[model samples]
Target: MSDEGRRTHGFRRRTPLGAARERLLEQVTPHGRTERVRLRDADERILATDAVAERPVPHYRRAAMDGYAVRAEDTFGASDRSPAQLRVGETVGPETATRVHTGSELPEGADAVVMVEETETRGESLTVFDAVAGGENVAPVGEDVEAGEALYEAGHRLRPSDLGLLKSVGNEAVEVYERPRASVVPTGEELVETDPEPGEVIETNGQTVAQYVERWGGEATYRDIVTDDEAALRAAVERDLDHDVVVTTGGSSVGERDLVPEVVDDLGEVLVHGVALKPGHPVALGVVEGTPVLMLPGYPVACIVNAVQFLRPTLREVGHLPHTDPPTIEAELTRKVVSDPGTRTFARVQVDRDGETVTATPTRASGSGVLSSVALADGWVVVPDRREGLDAGDVVAVEDWEWSG
Candidate 1:
């Protein structure tokens, strides 16, 4: 791993961000796997088939208030001065009323429910002080959902609120597309999990990528650091081919220690080597054994940017999840953000609001290695490839990158 054996730089020509993304995505496709899962295990799962209701919610007529189920016309024109009296019973008739509570099943021959506050019960007799029309204060069959109703179509991501509706429709389990499985392997000889001395770095990229995978609706398997060696890198990749996507962090550049891209290229084909991206131009993409292999930059900020651009979309595609754009907010730039004319830049900035105006101030620690800059930033302002820089006082939209919703 000395300079004498360093790999030559591959940036003879860098691919534009759009072209690189298109190339990478062309080789990736959905796994198309589906499985049945109980409601307890189906949170955030995508439906694989149309969900139709077999049974209507609240199949029986129900009381909507606490009082009595009685004929609506029996209490017409009745009031506290001259209340309508009826005998209490299990069933309702012209002169009889059945006591009921909210959500209670309506008794036979009852057309409506009279509220408890509008009626009084005395010695097995009920007195109604208010008038009610037919079907008032009552939930009839199919009020919430009718039988044979199509609740959801395929390719729909289920939310927490959806479980109750499915349950009410008699669905104890559902068929859903499998979550994309990701193998996040961290590589670098100088990487250590803890107690890092000088020249050694604490491993965090794998964990960060893994967590992001989960947040983006995929499953992640985080692995230990794979040393900077061709054999070790190849084995690490081979071990995770079963996963939907293989993600490797660190050693992705042209340095001698950056052997991941080489290993991937030797095993398969490197779709993209260098991209016209700021702080993360060294990111590489390839496919090995039909699995997309993503080689991210070692620097924390660079890795994050590349992950958000590449891995996030790859996971969504493989898992059959829809691509979601991160939320954004408009803000005024407090300082000029310089960018190369042909390179796409994501400038991290601290956001603040003054009365009615929001401001974005570029962080001092803006280098690829400055992880704190990106961490403290509320979001990022993207300077397009055509724009040289954004001047101060210019209004820009800052993407709320952390909001998954």
Candidate 2:
């Protein structure tokens, strides 16, 4: 066979996920700009610096329940059999013991809290049965978090709970990293705008990519749906070169209308042409105008998977945010999985953990175009390329579809 025929038939084999990821990381450099932002607008933003508590949480000692506070010694040795009676005026000051409710502060000279339920009220005196302990129902100062302590380290992503923590620490404003901006371009001749006629497929990748970008803490500032024409693709990519990151879908493979690689070569350098993973083998990475541009496959599943595997991590790395792996658990396969020995395969699976056994239901369709399988799956199983296949009842690691808690 000629070199062209051999190249067309089989030349470069698929790499394993680990090796592919390493190569990608080596090719791409982190974005080198950081800006400070306010906490109010810092939701999902990364923390460029560690946030220390401005002051001790619960700055003052507060009551935990509404009850009269008194010295514990005065109520000791008091029981139902022989109740101890103390005059209200002698035991506590005026307006202190007459009536108390939950979370009421203890009056001066009182050292312990006596619950109302433990005492029987009379005309001017009260009968006490149970003994009380000092500081039993009080929330001491700095009980939850100490002053000058680090609340969150640098590179932490601010969540709702983190905002609440900031509020508790009397922090009205906090410094965080500015959100990175991204541009998305979807290219395909068969794809039409969301509102399309009968045979044309509606453009869904842009919307999906935008949503995923937002969820991953990057703002999709530019979105354009272009045809497979090389000129249109190059123009769209050039327009989006000013963004921190640019993403284009379709036209990335070795087809007649595959203009992504050509445009990248014309505008900048192509870092990678293919990855060693199923559903996203034709993924491309490039740099243009000092901004990173990722060319993802056209299929919905392939696009989504590549977005998570590549784009999400890149954004987090450049934004100085911590990236966590998807939740995972051990599960037993319900059936066998036959796969090639070249690429790492991600199989859609439905996982249910009952008692100690986790059952995984493999989906029938694993095609890159099958978006429904991803939606229907509870998680996914990673089948290494070196392994021939997974037998029924084999225990494997299952990565959860969504982050839980």
Error of 1 at 226 (Å): 1.6
Query: What TM-scores do the predictions have?
Result: 0.89, 0.79
Model 2: lowest-lDDT 10 consecutive positions: 90-99
lDDT of 2 by residue, 92-199 (tens): 543234344554544566666667778877777778787767676666779898899899987777897898898788787777766677898888988887677776
Best by lDDT: 1
**Collision pairs in model 2:** 65-102, 65-103, 66-101, 66-102, 66-103
Task: Report residue 60 deviation for candidate 2 (angstroms).
Answer: 3.4
lDDT of 1 by residue, 309-392 (tens): 999999989998989899998999999999999999999998999899999999989999989988899999999999999999
CA lDDT of each prediction against the hidden true structure: 0.91, 0.76
